[model samples]
Target: MKILSAFLMLLLPALVFGAEQTLVLDVSGHCGSCKKRIEKTVKAVDGTSSADWNKRTKKLTVSFDDEKTNKDAIVNAVLKVGHDADGKTADNEAYSNLPDCCQYRDE
Candidate 1:
């Protein structure tokens, strides 16, 4: 009975998590600062449960309540802050607003 209870407890989280849909964003930016900006902005978006940005790969992993938000909203959030994600081009006006060093573009 004890072992069965423990197993159920462990499985419970997996079951719940599996049911919650998550969106992984392919973000493009320059460096650590860019990663931070993208992560912070996306996580602040309403309905986002969690967000992580990988500096090395320039990817942003976001977990949100699918019922409340969709992938387009997540991508737009990042773009609003002058970064690009999910194959959508960054807002040129917003991108031009970022500091020069934060710009991830070729001359």
Candidate 2:
């Protein structure tokens, strides 16, 4: 019937556009430059369609193709750039290499 057809039409787009999953990452660092660095690193990953890092909350939002990449890979990329993400510890070599202003250590 007409009502059934209209209902199906309305539901179709939602079904098509629904994301498989949404990943909310906690990234540690401060300042706008940190945001840019994290976002840029995440965006470089092949399956990431979009990435954003918030300086205020130290959170990174990433949308990626699950089939092509995964959460661990994304987290590692940020870690490699001297940022702590997804609960993983930062890489010592990468952390030591960051500019002084970008360093989060107390020392």
* Residues 5-86, model 2: lDDT tens digits: 9999999976776344558999989777888888899999978889988888888889987777889999999999988788
lDDT values for all models: 0.82, 0.85
What TM-score do all the candidates reach, one by one?
Answer: 0.77, 0.79
- Name every residue pair that clashes in candidate 1: none
Candidate 2 matches the true fold with a TM-score of 0.79
Candidate 1: misplaced stretches above 4 Å?
1-19
Q: Looking at model 1, which ten-residue stretch has the lowest summed lDDT?
A: 14-23
Number of the top candidate by TM-score?
Answer: 2
Instruction: Predict model 1's lDDT versus the native.
Output: 0.82
